[model samples]
Target: MIFDFNKTTDISGWRVVDDGVMGGRSQGSFALNANGNGVFSGTVSLENNGGFSSVRYQTDQMALGSYSKFVLKLKGDGKSYQFRVRSSFRERFSYIGKFETTGKKQTIEIPFATMYPAFRGRTLDLDNYNGETLVEIAFLIGNKKAENFKLEIVSIAVE
Candidate 1:
């Protein structure tokens, strides 16, 4: 099943989870655009050790073990962003896949086998993402170049 933004009128569980949780100055916001797309936009500040802003969605655990890839329909500023998925919500780390945007709309496919497990800012040498169930998903931008950024997401699907 796909998470279709166009068909969703209320993005109730989506929330901005920025560096502020760690006393950073970065700020971000998540909202639904008029086109019913998910919009994540905000400024990433370097003040107080802040360097990233993100938005996350928590959903019922989904068994994605059968899927080999994740597809995202999005438009973003010309920059790189991380797509993260977590099997356990209590874990401080997540499996991350980094992709660069082209400043235009596109469908990007990320192979599940390529995503690496990371904690804080360091990549763990543990096994790659092989989670059977996913409880959370997030998008984060932290190029370390501090700038205002925007990303519009239309849909996310597993295949």
Candidate 2:
């Protein structure tokens, strides 16, 4: 298991990053709900060119060469989101895959081989995820408009 959220899970490593870093007015928050699931919720404001909100977790490098995909157990507000990863935290770009939630519980599986390299919403010419090692993981919502989003995540695992 890569990460799981339960009644006792410690989520201190998780952080919310909005468009404020680039002069945007987005606001996001991450926390465990009463049911013990990790909740990522926020408003994506287009004010000041801001239109994205994300939550990220950085961890020790994990060798995952044997894992071909990641499975996310989550519930969303019928919106779209990006699941992202970085082999190394120092890298400026992340390998990302987009998924749409159905406003109900769902298991989203993202193949490591299909995550393309991207930076600031632009796809890079580099190859896709190598599935060798990972140091960071994130979820981002940025549909290019102002809206509110909420995602309840039960767990994240690779298989």
Candidate 3:
């Protein structure tokens, strides 16, 4: 699948998620440049002894037992970031992964099997995401000081 930013249908399946818990101080955040190319702009403050802060975009539904990999075009600050996905059957997530940014537009491809584990979040030994319900896509800042980060997702596809 090819995702075009100018196409509304391509972005309809996505949602935004940010800091803080439900109904709380939450993450120190805001939306930036709604009409511009940069829709998500905010500082990922790892404050209050915070380790991870992120934004997630998800599809309304998923075609399980089908796709093999997830691909996207992304640009980030001069730091590393984690890409997280959830299992359809669990509250936490079955898989989690880390990837570094080039500070430029680059294609990041993740195979379902190898990208399903992390240092945080729930754990599950899932072999394939072939038909697993696509839950969420998260960009996380690891446990550390405030990391001023930016991510512009130009496109996303499954195959």
lDDT of 1: 0.89
Tens-digit lDDT track for model 1 on 65-154?
A: 789888999999998999999988787799999999999998999898999999988999888888588898999999997899999999
Best-performing candidate as measured by TM-score: 2
Compared with the true structure, all predictions reach lDDT values of 0.89, 0.96, 0.58
Q: Which portions of model 1 miss their true places by more than 4 Å?
A: none
Q: C-alpha displacement of 37 in model 1, angstroms?
A: 0.4
Task: Give the clash count for each candidate.
Answer: 0, 0, 9
> If both were scored by TM-score, which would come out higher, candidate 2 or candidate 3?
2
Ranking the candidates on TM-score from highest down gives 2, 1, 3
Residue pairs in steric clash, candidate 1?
Answer: none
How does residue 142 of candidate 2 score in lDDT?
Answer: 98
TM-score, prediction 1: 0.95
Q: Write the per-residue lDDT of candidate 3 for residues 1-159, one digit (tens) a residue.
A: 534454233344444454455332225332333433333445555445444566666645565467877787766665777777765535555366667778787888878767755434555554534436676666665546565566766666777
TM values, all candidates: 0.95, 0.98, 0.71
